[model samples]
Target chain A: MKKFLGAELFFESLYDLGIRTIFGLPGGYVLKIYDVMPSYSKKINHVLTRHEQAATHMADGFSRASGLPGIILCTSGPAATNTITGITTAYSDSVPVLVFTGQVPTPFLGSDAFQEADHIGITRSCTKHNTLVRKTVDLPKAIAEALFISNTGKKGPVLVDMPKDVLISESEYKMPKEVKIKSYSPKVPLKNSEYESFRKVLTASKRPLLIFGKGACSDFNKKLISKFLNKSKLPAMSSIMSLGLIDGTNKFNFGVVGEGGSAVSEDLINKADLIVSVGCDLIKIVPESNLKSKDIVVVNIDKANFNARTKGNMNIHTDSDNFIEKLSAEKGLSFEWEADNLQKLREKYLNSQEKEAKTNKRAGIFKLISNLSPKNSVFCSDFSYEDVILQKFLSVSDFKDSILSGGNGTPGYGFPAAIGATFARPKSKVISISSGINFQFNMQELIVTLEQKIDLTIVVLNEKKNKQKKYSGPDYKSLGESFGVKSHQLSYNDKNFENNFKKFFNHKGTALIEILI
Target chain B: MRHIISILVDNEPGVLARIAGLFTARGFNIESLCVAETEKPSLSRLTLVTSGDEWIIDQIVKRFENMINVIKVEDLSGEDSLERELIIARISTNQKTRSEVLRVADIFRANVVDVGPKSYALELTGNKEKLEAFIEILRPLGLKEISRTGLISLKREKKKITER
Candidate 1:
């Protein structure tokens, strides 16, 4: 008889799914599961966050960096409620994540027992799928189903609420051979005809521009995009999510292009006759583009269904990579419009950007680090204007990674996500940048960095008093020292600040850089 | 303009709260709402009456369609549809007004369900306008308490069942 405790089987399932790290907080109802986690610690790392919400943010950052569903575990009541912001952020941005919450005993449900909260009810609207486990026998199956729903199709968050008694209960366990949700079947390897038509329209246009979004950030899409750009020789720009999925320094690359995008990108959008949309500008942002409905070609995963905003526009529903792969397969396309302005525009934008960065050193902290850094890696920031400054100054790279919370507009996400991003790629340098005020939201998570002792740099931007509000806060440098992490502070007036920045970078382990503006 | 939107959703717990809470949380007004199980055992149809401009109504319908467990949302206010509401009122009755009330009820084809010594319980099923008119005529008879099953509607055009 293959019998195991339900809680033990839960780890077996997650480990089998290739989940390396589980960001979580311990609680009474979750103690049964935590008891077994130490046995598997060598195989899986548990990053105990100061707050459950930060745990989810770390998972979100990990998912964005690795293109895998990040797992977050929490206890009942407040533990579960705290995760709502992260879950909604994932849902809004289409990042895949799995959330497991411990619930009060099954019998006590609806009776308002100790630490009881309706996890499924509260998160139903925000999540793509969720379930409350009743029978212990259903635990493994429910876990499998939650992962399946979150990882497939238009990816989003899925939650599973596990009762404490159910974790204690036993059943003959069999690892599910396969998991399936009957209603969801994401279209794959789109029909060749759809690709053929899209290719013809794209090839014929003299003034064509390609724009990619988060949907094109998957590993497979990265390969397809490089090949597509190489063959077609078309200039391109990234929508906020697609940053770092394309080479920012590439001559054809325009910076991110919407709402918070640059003037050059906007001008390119206005001048182009044909705008190719690879899963972006669909519902909300189209109002700003002002592009005629006829000029847009939306390529998505709908299997021939029209996009929300581009109802009458030409939309080819297919896997973005598969479609682009086939389009690029045909002997590579290059247009001759008598000294095409595409390459010229790229150089024009690059020159102006350099001039701007040189003039704006106040904005130059982000610019200098991005441009002069020896190694390229992941970047994470919050929903503040500081993010607008970062995106504007930083150059994106396809080989690197960047994680933005994507309009969740919540402040606490950047730093924790950077920690998780570093864990995703431990050897590489991960920069978690944020303004001073926003950085305090979850600065407590810095302890995890100390426990793990990884190479992570957290840069906090602080503004000095100009006879305005005083900088009445704790010394962040001293704060890092208290956590047993190296810290440095730099402001404009410091004559040796530049030299200290170099030494800080040379220092190993976890480091914090506070730059006063 | 007023709009009546019909939504079909999975008959599950907490789904009603999600829908009603969305309206209340967003401060969208709901004039009336009627919900019941549809012909299918697993599904429930909710009819909600609201008033707003074209843009507000569009946003509400689109957002409702995006909710989990919501299978379909149809705006029946714009199309040619049949609308009905049931209103039950307890009116103070006396010797002078009893026959008069019955005559008024007869004109509207309303039914007198119960007759207490001093009050008569009247039930009327019609469009909102007809019910409002009847309420006005019954005011002199001393209308007391009323319960209304808000507007529910369906398009007159013949159609096959939509896939869930």
Candidate 2:
């Protein structure tokens, strides 16, 4: 054990857990932690953001892109309150994030001291778990427990509220070998009887549809899921969060199937005899009326995701990979779907999309971006009409290739998430697509691109005129220039529009291309 | 249906609020609640009474099990369980009405804990129906005030199994 201050212990604990980066802005209660940040700078990289909300989103984006828990640190009161939206976003999407907020001294707690807030009380419902560190000795254990809780089970945001006095005090700290929380165990072992029942259900159904959600994205065995679907010859659909899990071009895969999804997939939801939803929450996506008549077999470890809102046929209490592996091993399991019918639906969907691209300029812009950007590019969009258009056109081949504020549908999620995604996937191109009003949510973050010299492309579809009567937004060209980044403006009918966009796309550094229609 | 949900949780601050907040947020009502330290000093047992349909009760149970501090949750609704509540009632009695109050207290097997010239404070422990009956019978005897501890329940186990 080593005697170290609470601030040092906090950094050391995170370093031991393989956390190399954090995003946040320091303030009054958190200044002491920042003062000692340089000592650990060689080991841990800290990204200073303009706002606490952006810092939270950056961490969330990092997690969604890399499958690593995003970590954020900030001060108490308003700073802590600011992270709530970002925290709720991660919570709704089942993305793991660790949020550390500095609080007032223990003596001043509940006295309405300056810069003090009840962080735990405010974040209780939103977080997977949250705690306030009252004593210096418990700081290390609290961080370990918070990390364990956030990264395991349903995987959402966890907060650790650190009182200022605790940060100033010193304690003999030892790294915990393992964290054991008796109350939480995400694993539900599959029984042989369960497999038998699942096989029976599969054998009885003729046209079974497979639906994927964010819960299935963590399997990392993307090929296994693909192979199972191909061998079984079952049609499949994806939720907004699981946009890229199944290849969009696959004959059996009918793109996304929710409010932001395609029309063909929604119609298919009504046609299927049975739904084998793997790691997806059907209650949020499918209407209760549609789900009532159909047989649903939900495969998810969390009991909370089961169909409490409607009647469910069966629940396989296990992870997607476990259930998929078992199902793939079954013999003589075949689906009775007509290939001709599926082909007709696929062709009709593609035809409608092509017609949309020809008619709608916004749809055309998305088509252009999808056609021009590298196949491995990561696209992040704010929750807006522009995101819906992007989702319809973008064919994602990689897991989480298309990111959005899916569960919470937060407006200003695109730009900051793009910044975080850039850091997470440095080898791949990262693009942030947003409309005029949505981009203004976190527009101040434009300086981050210039400051970090990040390689990212900002695509703004200028549709502010639609909301001009409500509010007038700033000029994107001037905003980009003031941030010292290359900026370009183009209209849909401009001469050599594609060529201008191509030049900006391959600009070799941070740049903005505002497309006006 | 009324459900007696007994929860075993780590004895820590803010834990009670976390468990209760789930019900409040979901628009579920808690009829009564009792909390005390368990035999294991590190844990606390909270017995809560609530009424809802089967589906709603199942959802509530799953949510309670999901909390980080909750070690275990059991719905004692269908189990062989014993429930009890303690109540203290104070009644004003004059010289003419003292015998009537004493007779009512005797019939309910209540112990007189405090006595004054014009008042008698009686304490009784029983199930919901018994307690309610005793209160109803004492109301006409110049009942002054009443305080009750919420229901606390435990499941029954075979005595031989533990002895072995």
- When candidate 2 is compared with the true two-chain complex, its DockQ is 0.51
- The DockQ-based CAPRI class assigned to model 1 is incorrect
Docking outcome class, model 2 = medium
Query: What's model 2's TM-score?
Result: 0.96
TM-score for each predicted model, relative to the true structure: 0.86, 0.96
Model 2: residue A431 alpha-carbon error in angstroms:
0.6
Clashing pairs in 1: A361-A364
> Candidate 2 — which residues are off by over 4 angstroms?
A464-471, B158-164
| CA-only RMSD, every prediction | 4.0, 2.5
Which stretch of 10 consecutive residues in model 1 chain A shows the poorest summed lDDT? A302-311
lDDT of 2 by residue, A134-247 (tens): 988899899999999999878899999999999989998876788987767766667789889878888998888989887888545477767776777788887778877887
Where is model 1 more than 4 Å wrong at Cα?
A1-6, A106-126, A171-206, A282-339, A371-376, A465-472, A490-500, B80-82, B103-111, B126-142, B155-157
Considering only N, C-alpha and C atoms within 3 Å, which residue pairs clash in candidate 2?
A: none
Q: For residue A56, what is the lDDT in candidate 2?
A: 93
Error of 1 at A81 (Å): 3.4
**Chain B TM-score in candidate 2, rounded to 2 decimals?**
0.93
**A1-517: candidate 1 lDDT, tens digit per residue:** 8777778878877888778788999999989889988888888888888898899999999988877789999999999999999899888887788999999998789898888899988897788778888888888888888888788766889999999998888887766888754334554667768667777887787778888877766677777777667666777887776787777656567777765565477677777778888876444554534775447788776422244444446777667777666665767566642235776777777777677677765456777666545555777888765476456667656533777887577787899999888878887678888878889999999999988777888988777666866565778888878888788888745888777677776657789998876
Give the CA lDDT, 0 to 100, for residue A303 in model 2.
Answer: 79
